[model samples]
Target: MSLDAEFERVSMPLENPFTISRGTQTAAENVVVRVTDEAGMTGVGGAAPSSHYGETADTVEAVMPDLLDAVERVGDPHALHAIESELRAVVEGNPAARCAVSIAVHDLAAKRLGVPLHRLWGLDPSDAPKTSFTIGLDDTDRVREKAADAVEAGHSVLKIKLGTVRDRELVDAVREAAPDARLRVDANEAWTPKEAVRKAEWLADRDVEFVEQPVPAENPEGLRYVYERSELPVAADESCVTAADVPAIADRCDIANLKLMKTGGLLEARRAIAAARAHGLEVMCGCMVESNASIAAAAQLAPLLDYADLDGSLLLAEDPYAGINLSDGEIRLAEQDRAGTGARPAEE
Candidate 1:
């Protein structure tokens, strides 16, 4: 039952400069984690530390030694619950670092069971929704071009980054480019309550499905104000970080957007989903910019989600690891042939 664990930092360039209301990212900094059992079976996971969440690659690397120590001390990869508890105990704040180990161990455990991670959880892959391809903020024309290209590439769902002075113009351009595509917009907490409501009116008129995080998390009342009046459904991304945050946002948002990096691990993400559902909210699983090492693991939870944004690796200029076949935005989980999270070095 002995296990060996290790990690490595990776810097992956984006296919394009990804911009949100908060800022832009040209690259994704990830730390890949590997957990190997006595039988030489290895599980892979990744930490895509986000500075927005008070985590960076350096922070993840700084804490890996203690996290791995906790894993080895626990010694059994199958003891996932115990392992997660140990990881939490070892590092109180580094959810990204803890998430890396969590993914790796889950991957290993699933491999040992000779099943894909979703199958291990007994989820029906057919229920999984097609993922949304994100169109990061750019000039209106460029945004339109990206939307058209995405539709041509078979992406029926597009998540557009909003929160600019010309939000209406950008939405107009995208709608013109892909009139039939399902559109969702994320303001990333960039608007005032009244402004969000006004924008939401026009956004709804344009057939946008939902408006995500229209106001800052700090202004709970503002979020509730917009949610109570917006023409479109509201989804809480920044406000709903963990399971504990769900109940507070339940009355304010129609959807709870959970990210693995924000929730820390697969188990915690599940808990958050359950909590959100319990509070009568739909669930969406999102991701930070990441490699397949982590995105693959996130994809395993697709069946349990109402929405999916697991396109992190797809946005990468090149991903050294490959997992899942998200051809044309369909999360072809049942089509996968490998065990575990299906994440492995691409060279393999």
Candidate 2:
């Protein structure tokens, strides 16, 4: 059966300004893709572009028409690799755009087979770990409030954003508010190697589980320097982009945070996971601030990861799609009876 594809731009407001070390976003700019087979089944996917990765809403919009055209030419949605190669030939470095098509194809294939994506992948939903709710960079009071809210919402893990002079104060405030919540921090490449080492030691004392991207992505030596001296586990978010980048930094960091937006989609994400494991680096599945469409697609890979930061949809003031359910930080995937990614447009 032939396939038809289409895309639309979407903007979802955040519950509050989501400030990371790089910048702040009051809303997320995303592109949603839908693919329909001649059989009349439709599958949905989305991309949340990041400027840090050289992708913006404008870039995504510019590349999507050709990308979708490439997808439409593919004869089989199940033949993901063939479709991926065709799309890659159409454009370069637009991972988010590639991701939108890759996921839409996967969703369509799963739907055609009449199985939920996780089931089709032979994964057990119960094995999927609980996701961590993020507390973005903010004033100490707002940090405390966000931490408190996460704890009250039954989230067992809280990933805090750091990389400022107030880093220590923010961690202290969050700990005070949610004493029992597992704490993790992402510096977003804001620290020097020496600063990262110092902060890691300080954070270890505060019971921080791990530190993410403490040093800049471009500085593998800085990452290695901190990893060698720090008492806490160091995770490479910015440092690791694709599976090929994994082996080079595998010895420098304890964990690799893989996001669909970075790897281009689930196919590459799975490959990156295997690559990380091959190099003895643990894996964390993460996402950008996106709607449920993309978050749900990322959620399908949760069973294969050691950690999950798939709360992007939860950060939205309103999500137009629904798929995964987070109860007390636990990730509950859509039922097996549902087809494709099991994420559909919200019913008003």
Per lDDT, the best of the predicted structures is 1
Please provide TM-scores, in order, for all candidate models, with all chains considered together.
0.99, 0.98
Q: Which ten residues in a row have the lowest lDDT in candidate 2?
A: 333-342
How does model 2 score by TM-score? 0.98
List all candidate RMSDs to the true structure.
0.7, 1.1
lDDT of 1 by residue, 99-192 (tens): 9999999999999999999999999999999999999999988999999998999999999999999899999999999999999999999999
Model 1 C-alpha lDDT versus the unseen true structure: 0.93
